[model samples]
Target: MYEYVRNPSLIHEGPLSKARLPVFLVHDGGGTAFSYHLLDRINRPLWGIENAKLQDGGWWDGGVPAMAAHYIELLGKVMPEGGDILLGGWSMGGLLSLEMAHQIALTAREAKNREGEAGDSGASTPKAPIFRVRGMIFIDSIFPLRLAELVGPLPEEPVFLSAEESRKMKLKDKVNLNMTHARMMVRFWQVPQWKDIPVPPTILMRAKEFVSRDSDENFVDYTRDLRLLGWDQYNEDHGHFIRDLWEVNGHHFSIFDIKYLDDVTRKVRKAADKLDPPDF
Candidate 1:
């Protein structure tokens, strides 16, 4: 079980504004579940996250399916009985969320059938899923398919980081650092594929990396493509690392910028508001 850092003194400081945020966050290769601490203003009542699980230094070998299963179990434990919830993540977490949702839907269907055969009343138990998701949010993460396009087909074998870089890049920072699994999974989806997701109102917060002495002319185009693919709304910022709660801005390739985080977090709040359940 993943233990959470719940400090009473810091209770008023986490990003859980309402009673339950029910948000799932996937941190960067070098980050942890607490990576979203910078956006603490947006109180999230329910948070299911795992940090640095991918930073194992052994490439993409961090158990993606296993992590997903853990969160699904967490949802079973914490989510209100027969309650719907929101799911989202950043980078690899985001990708994992997508896969998790797909698997969860399958599980729910199978469970419903099993219960029906056991004489469970159809009126009491809904045939569809007990929990319907509001939307999925992706923040500054890599899209496996997009990556395969940028870099030729991923190597089938696991790619380990050289010993020195592994020491510098802690385990928390290398979650899903390997490309092998991503390559294998990327082929499952076809391009222009947002239509398949059953959820509504998706958001994709993309980051614009400002390479030194280089013009990112393709940034706008790529962000546009992401929007067309599935994100209901997309915000592009200039930061590589997840924004800090103490400080809105973050460093990208050693360059710090604050405006991007400010704008993106603001947008996240707005998007979240739109996620509020429909009036009864």
Candidate 2:
């Protein structure tokens, strides 16, 4: 599910390994990690967790919970002794990251029980994987539930689907699968269950514009709760504590453009550094 963007970068020699905290990023709507290549190298180990549909022909289990659960299993392959890690993504990817954190917290109890059993079995064995999310970075990400509510009606069927593809899918299957995954994402988060889940330290990067607005106006400039992108509506239980915001120059889809890469990288690196210091 995950692909490395930075492979134990040369910046980390043997002694500096202590500073290597991998950032496992979830994929955006494109269902692949291709766009993440645009990020300015922040020097930390980088990995992108891709959607299963991209390779498995849309037959994988659906919903954010299933995706989150599977991604956690995959994380074990790279960081088996799971400790602290930063979680982040763009747009829908960010929404999915939020679910991943909730799933991690939800399973912590079971993990603890299993960890006890492992400890009892052997004293010299490697620690069983039990990951902790240190913080989250949401790039122009709004809660899908809020979005679905705002967008009200979905089309009966997207006009893109063709008659022949319905009978025997070809390349259009990718487009069909993308819509399937999107619906699954919206459906899963539409229900309000993770409200009680603690909100971790978060860095929310809002684009200058979600859509064209009045001259000199940004989308957050009109939100009821300031710049949160309507997240305060569902995140009602846990008030913002470690949350920070960084405004980027561009629309939601175009914010990852190369021109803003350095600025974006700086804000993310600053947030990650605060979330997990070297001593941490």
Candidate 3:
């Protein structure tokens, strides 16, 4: 039941050209594609992967790897044959994007190895990959941690007791959907060590205000851990190349708010433009 928005309108002026690869975006935890309506400001093809769970009789029961695989299949259908692609997402969607990039890289590697073997064995190799991820963009996304740490506590009164009930419930309430997504995130993190793999040219648009101000006595800054553990290691291991981080105004959610839409779109477009084909 997942819906794909093919010709999404741009918030600012300018039409997307067919020559360039479209940027595929995953929805935030609220499972709302409209949440990213502001990104239309970027003068490029934009595709939003609407959450299947939000639709009646849709399927999405929490598992980052599974979710990534599902999207990869969908991506193949939309992208041109052997074309380049850009992947990005906000919040929980960002984490999903990272995973998708990793899977794409793995698949590409496998294809390359197959081609090499074919060359050696005098066999016909496939012309090119179905699609290659050119860049990855993360908007205020953090590395995964325990659910209890991320969200204080689970609600005592369950909104949708069962998947069947969730399917039946109206998707009008954003709060309800957010709560459901939060639980799914918790479950996603509970799975055994789902670490991030090295991706293509990447950029992280961090919300400075939110991470700086919002801190309870016991709150641990996962973003700090991301800088130290994820970003730092990635740079060191990859020769200090292919990654950029920019601090933007507003809180985590508000960074994508209408007031900062122009700023956000500009940064994203800049990052996407900077991407180069991955060197095997």
Candidate 4:
């Protein structure tokens, strides 16, 4: 029933190599798969992950979780055998990565359990392929509930609340004037389930920006929690998304910048290299 999931077409800077495992890169809020063209600029072979119905008005109305699941299903197809997939996202996409990682880990565990039972019971259960997700990378994403109070209260529609409550809720998140998308991301991130994401995730954040508005004490507390969780946190001197000066439509999110994109792709490569099965 999940075959409807699809991967977006992409333009590539270098030749596609089957030797390299595919990295499925999802875009942030208000972004299409095309928005991740920076991955091409970084000379990485990434399958740009986007929703097929993104052009339709109601595609994102169901909230990020639904879209996240769609992307994850599509990712399963491109990911190589023996667990060689690298999953990464920016902003809202980072939240999606968390959800995807949780699902992948759950799927992998269940598959292993089924295999063991087949031998013990002498049943003819076919060997199911293991969905090995190597690593998850988060860039400039918020910690749970950290920025919600600063962004003000979440609205009562779609991501903010429910779609039925206000038809304009999704539009509110799409508003580029203020940081509405950032606010909604932080609000839902507060859910305890997000903390349960079962993967070795590296969080690359704009350190100064996320904590600049808060007191030094609060910043320390926040960083402490991140460290305690064994999160590999890195600092960036840019906005939540990197700066992209060549954006055709006057959008200036930096996560699309060549320099920033290169930095992240390298980090993802290094993390993947360290995976137990060796994702070379």
Better candidate by TM-score, 1 or 2: 2
The TM-scores of all predictions, comma-separated, are 0.60, 0.74, 0.73, 0.60
RMSD of each: 8.1, 5.8, 5.7, 8.6
lDDT of 3 by residue, 11-102 (tens): 23324333455677786766666766767445566677756555432235545677777777776555436467788887767777877777
The C-alpha lDDT values of all candidates are 0.47, 0.64, 0.61, 0.48
lDDT of model 3 at residue 138?
A: 79
Index of the highest-TM-score prediction: 2
Best by lDDT: 2
Query: Compared with the true structure, what per-residue lDDT tens digits does model 2 show for residues 193-253?
Result: 6555566778888887555555332322345245577767555556663367778777776
State the local distance difference test value for candidate 2: 0.64
How close to the true structure is residue 104 of candidate 2, measured as C-alpha lDDT? 81
| Greater-TM-score candidate between 1 and 4 | 4
Q: Model 3 compared with the native: what TM-score?
A: 0.73
Report, for all candidates in order, the number of backbone clashes: 25, 0, 1, 5
What is residue 264's positional error in candidate 3, in angstroms?
Answer: 1.1
Which wins on TM-score, candidate 1 or candidate 3?
Answer: 3
**Order of models, best TM-score first:** 2, 3, 4, 1
Q: Using lDDT as the measure, what is the rank order of every candidate, best first?
A: 2, 3, 4, 1
Once model 1 is optimally superposed onto the true structure by TM-score, how far is the C-alpha of residue 214 displaced, in angstroms? Answer: 4.4
